[model samples]
Target: MAALWPLWGLSPGGSFWQRFAFWADALDPLLLLAPADEIRRSRLLLQNSGKTLSEPIQDDQMRKAFLLSLSSVHPDTDKIIPVLFRPPAFLPICLPLVIVSSLHLQAKATFFSQFVFHSYTTGFALINGNSTTKAEEYSVQEKQIFYSLGAISYAACIGAFPLVFMNRYTMKSPLMELIVRKLLPAPLLGLMSAFTVAVVRSPEFEHGIEVVDRNGKVVGVSQKAGEKAVRETALSRGVLFGTTFFLPNVLTYFVQRAKLAKTPRNLAVVRMLFTTLVLGGMLPASLSMFPQRGEIKRADLETEILSSTEEPVLFYNRGI
Candidate 1:
């Protein structure tokens, strides 16, 4: 896995495409079902191999285990994130919710779907973020409930805005109506997704997460790094949800125009498939947009962090 990073251009400050390739391999859906014992063995093999350099592990089993552990385990916590919130399960769980959220259903159904989607995404964002090394400082359960409610409330109200608008006003032009119905949801959903992530992960920004040197030694807690981490996650999420929501609707529109699926049932099936494919592809791409192990220059960090470490470049876990 270490050797594969360079091959995939996954340097400390690697480009987006490099990050994307790493995610594509890491987020394989089949890995989600790996047995608990197998995962334990994989982690053990990785720990015992002691291969610290960029050279590839000689054993194929070790390499596979490395990838599995990388996707499933949180580096800071060293615990398996909840299965539903893990990256491997992201596409499978989110695709259907996103498809339903984008659909022009009754007002009640639309709000319900939007609420569920936001709640799930919020949980994912919170879990995948840089969790505090100190557990005693914050109330995890209380914060989770509070943030979840806030995100769902925002999503429900904003998500319903377009539908409410359409119902209240009669558009004279079919083109205008089409724009509102088809084109508006993508950006709106994208914005809401980003907002939910920022809100759910706000504690990290407020309290700060740990920053470490290149050698993985803790220097100090840095709020600046926390802010940057949240910002990057939010941007990637916007891209993920924005493109996922937008492309399927546009493609479905063109398909309908071309008479690709004559019947409503056929069209629904086609749209569902399209949504699945788009989300599967976008999820990895968006995840790769930034390095999971992010870097910060010594000067960019807080003054206390600057005093604590002389290393020119420091690293932190930028949660997936």
Candidate 2:
């Protein structure tokens, strides 16, 4: 049997198969299955059957041996619930889930298709009616609408043009085709979503976001603070999407490897359901890491709004 993992990290073995095994093992946390017992069982079975799975188990032939042994281990333990019947369909949407559960503007995708493509941004002025001179609050919602329109209006321009260029009467690898047709769309949307949020919210930099004093009274606005806040929001959105970027592809790979689905559509449905649940569980923890109302040192403020005797605390709403 393979030895226990080291205290530090996954140990790199001397060969490629060993490396692949290590990564495959790494994927279990994301898979939500504790694989230690199953893996050990597979190793023991192979050994008992007179198959040598050495410290360096580098043979391609051993791949089938390992899978055969591993196949005996059940992935699901609960007999009471079937997969589809475990959850409802369509009551909650991914976009809003991506928004509220997001760690901020970062994880929320502006999607256009099952491939999750297309987006645009708009600028809106949010002016406080109470203030004598209104500071136009940047219209993030307007920006999203414009992004949606742009995605719909020029769908061919963005998605098709590149695809056409990639396939332009020339032959390409199957991997490249997968990248162009399937793997590429979601990350592209993610990048566009990040870019859109940053640019549309730039108005915050000009008008400055409202910074409150220690007592929560609105003092003079700070453009620098707004820039910092917006930058973090944009970055968090990128981080949110980062872990999920390859999720669908990875799920497809594992499902295929296990032959889990009865058909293509079945595989797709299972992948989607898993993605939704995994993301739902992840969102709350990610968002909870940072406070919605962020704090800053009063001394960091560009505007000297705080009095000499005032406390060294200030606050701003870090938007989702």
Candidate 3:
């Protein structure tokens, strides 16, 4: 009675009718008949002083049978009423918007990928010199620069979403036309911004000083040591930044480009190639930097000293 009252929202007159209507509508689907059976059982119980139609059977067994019958029937109009007859309250309320908005993501990804392949990668190769001696040196340095710029570029591109929205709202035009017109430059901007940042930071590589011991002797050569440090930094930062911010935008670009191509074979090839180069490459590089990998998690000198001191504890006498 208490539970039923709450279900009725603490009122009897209006609540009773609402509750009755809800149940009737829920049962109206006829998909299941358990509700009708339960209603009949309730009526019989009221008329017969707590005795059910199956009164010859034990209460526990009869209750179990009733529950079994309820569970066995499929929900339908014939068996029961529909709850909230207009539409399912929860059948992906966002689905229509998603279908409508999918073009944006696709356009963004397409623009981003083109910018990366054509501009970012190519620009660096030219600036750093593509010859063998320069190539070997610059490959390592270029990766480090890429690590920093990738995240910033990706974020800036996504930040343009407000403009995309503005275009949609202001123009009394088809969404596809608005998208194509507004989003065409997304990839070029994303790639160029990332590339420019990488170039600016490249000079920072030469400025690091060498670490010295108490004796004033250089422990390691400055440039070599700096290279190692930078590599470690890049390993930790680069691929993650690229994958999270860069890859999705780039994928959107590639997908849109494929759509524009209008050739199924070309689209499939482009998608596979993009996935292989962007996502596939980024994953392994990111995983390689995990702190859990091998000796990367090893304790520093202070920790090692502390660990060494603990070895004597088990042998020490408490009495002393």
Clashes of each: 0, 9, 31
Can you tell me which runs of candidate 1 are displaced by over 4 Å?
Answer: 1-15, 53-59, 133-135, 169-176
Worst 10 residues of 3 by lDDT: 311-320
Candidate 2 runs further than 4 Å off: 1-91, 95-161, 169-172, 306-309
Error of 2 at 62 (Å): 60
Give per-residue CA lDDT, model 1, range 151-211, as digits (tens): 8788888888767677778543778767767888889889999999888887777778887
TM-score of 3: 0.22
Q: Per-residue lDDT for 222 in model 3?
A: 31
lDDT of 1: 0.77
Residue 46 displacement in candidate 2 (angstroms): 64
Deviation in Å, model 3, residue 90 alpha carbon: 29
Highest-lDDT candidate: 1
Query: Can you list the residue pairs that collide in candidate 1?
Result: none
Number of the top-ranking candidate, with TM-score as the measure: 1
Per-candidate TM-score against the hidden true structure: 0.89, 0.53, 0.22
Q: Write the per-residue lDDT of candidate 2 for residues 1-320, one digit (tens) a residue.
A: 01211100112233445444443332232222324565455445454544221233445445433443222221112021221111111113343333222211111122223223222121211110011112432454454346445544353244344465565756468877677655765565456445544655665665566666444446667776677666666565555454454565577678888998879878767666655665554343333334434567878777456553265776665443
